[model samples]
Target chain A: MTRVHDMGGRFGDGPVDPSPEPVFKEDWHARALAVTLAAGALGQWNLDTSRHARERLSPKDYARFSYYEKWISALADLLEENGVVTRDELMAGQGAGPSPLSGRKLRADAVAGALARGGPADRPVDSAPKFAPGDVVRTRRPARNAFVAGGHTRLPSYAAGAVGRILHHHGAHVLPDANAHGRGESPEHLYTVVFDAAELWGAPERAGDEVTCDLWQSYLEPA
Target chain B: MPHDHHDHDHAHAVLPPDPALRVKAIETILTQKGLIDPAALDEIIDTYENRIGPKNGALVVARAWTDPAFRAALLEDATAVVAELGFYGRQGEHIVAVENTPEQHNMVVCTLCSCYPWPLLGIPPGWYKSDAYRARAVREPRKVLAEFGVTLPGDTRVRVWDSTAELRYLVIPMRPEGTDGLNEDDLIPWVTRDSMIGTGLPGRPE
Candidate 1:
């Protein structure tokens, strides 16, 4: 469950490089962004599903590919998976037949409008929020089944099993774990959980430090 | 179309680098399939670069520094307040403005992935998306901030916002000292991208 992508607190990561460059380094990077967004606008998969497709890659491949390269790969995978584009079409860089979803094109003029009207994950739920602001809570220890399954999860590895206090109740939002799997939007209360550095990383690392995370109700319990 | 002239030397010389060629090939294929409009691609790129960038965020910070009412509105309902100024979309659909004061500072990071407020801040810088930052930010934020040349007072509390959900964070960096005479327009230049992200402070006027 804890993949290389989830490297929150564990060390050995090299020093942060402060190189300044334009958003797209190469031409393909821009194309990668465009193609991914275009494909995504067709409504074949949600954002979480797109993210999971990239996370599902082998660690070796994930490490080797640049950020846009990962997106391009994921786009290709999703195209084939959704029957929008075929594997042979991707390999040959040409369509073998008419696109399956030819009618679902996002026009050039609609780009800005579509992005501005983002798909908000918030959904109405009947149950009231369990925790309020200032309530002490502890992060649930990540279950072995979910971790070993290697499915999409919003709970970062570093925050799991950590104790925190609720800073705010963010109302009900779609659970990303379920959304990624095509499960219904099992909406839940989202809260801003504030953890002391001492609680998360232990002593010497303490001192005037706190980490706040937007956690779902399922990830927390009363401390 | 160019692939037809496949003479070995011409192929080697005329072909772009691997990534460029790969992207070109994909673009051409998608265009042929009628999946993506080239004009739309250009529009998206233009929107991010020219229309929506850190300047929009700088303006918001500048206004917040000068107008208490706007600041209150931002802290209370960031999404609506920012949209009032015409900066709302995509990653910025839900935003919460966290203020940095004399006693406390705020920083933001997406531990799981590169989640940034594109409508306000444009694309995130390379360092924000780096593995080093993702790991160290929540663990040793002081050290990371120091690396960004932002050494705070020993007693100043550092609050790191890990963006794990839909709500994005924008750090309303503390106004620098000695800028009492500067108007809102003049103060816009002081608000840097890193300042909004809480990695560094706004530039103090000399």
Candidate 2:
């Protein structure tokens, strides 16, 4: 009864394997893709200009909070600032009854119902394979700290310039990089690549030591 | 999987197949209602997935598993050493790694916006992603764990890691029951995704 995109759905039923070597991209396009993802981490989109709803909090407060908290806080701040909802209204929990314009409930209904009914989209969910099991690739490192929320990001900096190979083509997943552009981007290929510890963080006496990362196609390149 | 709590009301609840579509829907709703500024949402999503997502946490988990001294170091100052690993996911800047002992168990949840220890646990489990897990984990954790097939005896005290301002916490689950005589290479297999989340114990196939 699980949806294809459900958590832990992409990997095969067998024990998850860790063998695709990391792929390294050589061109600017590959690098740009990496930059987009890194920059997207900072939330500077091509067209995104709206400010957050909460503004009175400390800068330290914003950085210390969880990602979703930041979203909620920002939304609240923005809503109040733009006069969409006032402090009194929100604090009072007024006009908070689900807005009719809200499509979450409706969309959730339609999609869940269709998926439940065994619609075409509900066919045994399978991850479309991309990049064969042994394709070598590399990660791109782009300078993306120029925007707001500059530099302090989640994408591992050690992954920059690291090379490995595609061990498994998990499936397409939402590309946060494009979403950061505020362009409403869709999911892209997700892969698990094995990087030699030597290549990523200098040599360890144990030459075979390595790490497997679930990387988006955008972060990969031909090695 | 607990039927007692999940009634038929969820039958009509639509689960978006595409994560992006789901986010889009949230974005659209927020935008239409002017609940959030478009730019801010962009930043929020950006940080959630990129800045505070699971990838960052995976590295920390892997490192803790490998480095004993680092593991001790993490237990002492998880926030600083986790940063030394070069990963600081959203809400990850402040970190606290809690060890799960034979007597006590640990789990994490953000009753708010999926507040997770992404720098250590990666993306949340599906159950963790749901409102039920988030709301219930904080209030009635014992009930929620029972729902997840995790039952703690009354004698055992389950510590629910509520990620917060000064620090976010991750449960370094007990190494599986029968992992003795196993090397790190072989030991990794016992590390089930669930173990990383602290809901289940790691176990080896007989």
Candidate 3:
């Protein structure tokens, strides 16, 4: 579904302030990240699910929250949905005690190695790639009101219906649009498509500039 | 729905609007629930806040500048080359090194979300994740680069890598001239975080 997080070519954004920022602004920002990662080790949800939870936030809340705040809200929702904790427990600051899932926790010692060998997204597919490098392709424009329930997708709105040439074939990877809804990982051929800035924004001054997006085969159609 | 949110406080205090207080409450509850170990949480926090960061990526860039074989290997297979140097982890399962030269400038952005090379560069900079950068970086990169005090030559081409998927990119920024005499140790300090991300250039020899 189209959300505020799908911001790409839309205008009226504020000017960027290029300044060095601390890794964590407050003590809680660190906690938010760590708790999210630690709980994520539970294998209750995947990265795309956590991302869709944030995007599902009301535009008002999404705009109001700081970066880490967004993570906190999403983690809270994911925790509740996965039956790891209850809203009452959160309000009470203590659960009905730990559940059986509690025993499967990430220990302090494994943190370094676990993060180093991150979960790989490239899964092997049974079928051959549909398209290869140098193939021109177009992205599908979704029908209106498509994302009724589990409308999790990685295709940003700006690139929808845009035609571009593929520069590289990245092999089979998980398709997030399907995976976000508890749908099985539908591995698809992934390619990096190069679009001219002028093609995306229609600005004459952007003639010499180009933009590239890593897209899954499911999003593309032969042009 | 009243039960779904802690809005409208009872005789008890509702979760504070302060995010710190809210996160505190969630953590306490999650810990008590046994889903999160306090020690594990500490380790994760310590690692990002202190251990992993741009210095790791800077080391790779310095090696590419000093060693031709590493540069070729980095361009050929960044994920394997970086892992060889012990710099492989989350958000960096796959990496493609894009080189910047006088004829072409490259910048990286995740317009949809902040999908950065965290293992290589640590947490993304504030601007890289800001709404403005997410919207304008892909739409008008030259303009965005200009705001960052980067003025490319009129003939130079601009390339914006919007990595919305799992394949992360590290920009192999062109090494500044007159630094040929410097060793990799001397070159390490010249590579800034933004330089590796392609929003800026390497520091000139001093």
Candidate 4:
């Protein structure tokens, strides 16, 4: 489905104001980010799961909230949905008892270590890549509201059905569509496909410009 | 239509709903549940705020400019090469370093979400994560570049990399001219945050 979160190339976004700004415009933004990260370190869900949770909001809420605000709200829902915390306790602003998952909590000294040794998504796969660097490919075009189980998809809406050439193979990685759901880590050969900007936007004047996207094998078909 | 006048769905919405207060409440609840460590949150915030940032990326660019072998290593295997310099972490896994040339200029964006090399360039800028950038960078990069005051030559091919998967992209912007006499350390100041992101070029040597 072309969810609100996937709004690439949907016009009327207006000119980008690339003004210089601080990392966190407000103090709460930092707290919100750190809290979300710390809670995520509890081993309750994976990165893809967190991303899906953020995308689960209603169309109205998703459009209204700020970046970190969405993070904070999604985290609250995940904490309850994953059974890490109870809704009643969250409403009461007090724990019913002692913290259950003490062993999994990230401590202060270990924060840097955890951030350094990131959760690597690359896994061993028994299959070889089907396409090479020079092969031409076309992205899978799903009908609007018809996608892979209606879960998280890395293929932006704009690239659907667009033709491009494989620039390089990025090795087999976890397929987010399956991983975001409860399905297993279905690995797929990922490749960088380069598309001419003119072809992407149907503009003849922009012939020299190009755009490259990192796509999984399933999202492409030989052209 | 007016049955639910108030936001009864999110109980907190009934409150003032101030972002700061809302975050404080969530942190308090998670702390009470023992799911989050307050100290860890502080550490994560402090580390990103002060310790890690664009300086690390600038240093990497400087080393690449001074050492051809290092630049080759970077383009070949950025994850391993950057790790050798003690720069490796979350949101930066499986990096691909694309160099910018006069013939083709490279820029990076995440149309799906905000996926940046945090260990190197730190948190993404506000504009980088905006809806406008995510929507337009992949579609009309030349126009986007012009808005950033980056007026490229008419012939230079603009290559926009829309980061969609686990692999993060880092643009090796072309080194500024007239800085041939500078050392690696001296070259560090020439690199800026936007330069690495492919939005703005590095400043001239002072």
Q: Which regions of candidate 4 are displaced past 4 Å? A: A143-148, B1-16
Candidate 4 residue lDDT tens string, A1-223: 5577887666778888988888888999999999988988888878887887666666677788888888887787777767787768767766676676867889999999999988788888889999999999999886132234556778887888989999999789988777776677788899999988877788733677888888899899999
Native contact share for candidate 2: 0.01
Interface RMSD of each: 7.2, 18.6, 3.8, 3.7
Question: Is 2 or 4 the stronger prediction by TM-score?
Answer: 4
Name the regions of candidate 1 deviating beyond 4 angstroms. Answer: A143-148, B1-17, B204-206
In the range B1-206, model 3's lDDT, one tens digit per residue, is 11123223221223556889878888787777777789988899888888999899989999999899999999999999999888889888999999998888889999877999988899888899899999988887877888888888888888889987899999989888889899998999899889988888889645
DockQ winner: 3
lDDT of each: 0.80, 0.45, 0.82, 0.83
Listed in order, the DockQ scores are 0.37, 0.03, 0.57, 0.55
| TM-scores of chain B, in order | 0.88, 0.65, 0.90, 0.91
Residue pairs in candidate 4 whose N, alpha carbon or C atoms collide under 3 angstroms:
none
List the candidate 3 regions with Cα displacement exceeding 4 Å: A143-150, B1-15, B204-206
Q: Give the better candidate number (2 or 4) by DockQ.
A: 4
Better of 1 and 2 by lDDT: 1
As a whole number from 0 to 100, the lDDT of residue B107 in candidate 1 is: 94
lDDT of 1 by residue, B20-104 (tens): 5656666666677777788988888877767888999999999999999999999999999999888888888889999999888
